[model samples]
Target: MDDAGIYTRESEYLDCYVQLGLASDRVLAVSFPEESDDEDADHALLDRIDAYLEGEREEFDDVAVALTVPTDQREVLETTREVPYGEQVSVERLTRMTPGLDASSDEDHDAVRTALAANPAPLVIPDHRVRDGPSGAPPEIEQRLRALEGL
Candidate 1:
């Protein structure tokens, strides 16, 4: 695993983890291999993170992206579009899980929870597609939630 340094001014950081012989170009262009238990592996990782967070074993403020392999392909692929692996949930929904807050409150804990549960794992999107949108929550939030839930 390699730390890609913080793009803090842009509110982002890149971390790359390499798997043996996993072609970066192919992995980005296609879905995970059908025969590989990648989904289960991903879930297990999420579970571990959740447990660590819930047990207060670690501290985090928002979710961070996980790149399986390091590459210079930060730009979006023009030919290959990404299809989300799971249900699409809006950022609004995730923020609903935070307690003691109204729907309009920006820092509601329920809203944070909603975001965490809705998108439990890091998502893969084209580099060009990534943008600094309206939601300014830091990447550490995901870590905080996992510790809160002790998943």
Candidate 2:
């Protein structure tokens, strides 16, 4: 069953590669359109996400989301928000992006990976921009997003 207050969206440009669900103003799930089993949704939030996917805009900072993430994970995810379109950063590099994070520890490095794996907002935060990083979108979707960026 769908979570209460969640909405579904499919990309017009890369509808095959991207479909997303939202809950409480935040992205809840992301997948290939073919893989999504979501009800029809035409909320403003979905339109904003689709607009971003189509390259008509940049930055979802105004979208306003409420995520239930740990302080460390939230910091990593927030840093990803600065990753410009068509750019990619490695997980190891992302680990250091967070302030005061100990880059020398193996555990600290893995924490970035773990945080990414639990990302609640994918395209909005653009998790695909992280090289070889965890993605809420499918492989094809990630590829499609990159392709749109002409990468």
Candidate 3:
């Protein structure tokens, strides 16, 4: 769910960090490049994130990363369209084409939370369906009912 395009070259790492931070609240710590350094500093920062995630650090999850760059960098971002593996696809394009879960937004987060809370599933039914004409149900029927209830 990273909104940023893939990390290919060396200059786009700060945007990558911002994207990762937005995706995972667990990234409580981030250090950006000094304003004077060459742009290649971004690559180092991205490498750090890769190490953290690969190390089985608990901070990583299916979090969404949104890439944000200064307006001037728009052309550089667009260049990502030529990247292979399709990882460089813009967030807008990805959201429009993917199915199952729709693209997430600030508003949709609340909606998803509300839906999950309201519909904890596994329907409950009375036991009479499996019982004999005027008697209580047997053990096997009760077991089946309990299993369904657990679902």
Question: What TM-score does prediction 2 earn?
Answer: 0.77
- Per TM-score, the best of the predicted structures is 2
- Give the alpha carbon lDDT tens digit for every residue of 1-151 in model 2: 4333655555567665345555545565555556456666767666766777767656676655556789988888888888887778888787778786777778988888887888776777778888868876666776777777766
Tell me, by lDDT, which candidate is best: 2
* Ordered list by TM-score, greatest first: 2, 1, 3
**Model 1, runs deviating above 4 Å:** 1-85, 109-151
Model 2: residues with Cα > 4 Å off, grouped in runs: 1-4, 16-39
lDDT of 3 by residue, 1-151 (tens): 4323222222232222222122232222222222322333244335644453333222222322232433322222222222222022333333333233244663433332232222211011122121121112233433433343231
- The alpha-carbon deviation from the true structure for residue 57 of candidate 2, after best TM-score superposition, in angstroms, is 3.3
Tell me how many clashing residue pairs each candidate has.
29, 0, 2
Q: What is the per-residue lDDT of model 1 for residues 29-81, given as tens digits with 9 covering 90 to 100?
A: 11212133232333322343435423434322132333333121121111101
Weakest 10 consecutive residues, lDDT, candidate 3?
119-128
Q: Which of the predicted structures, 2 or 3, would earn the higher lDDT when compared with the native? A: 2
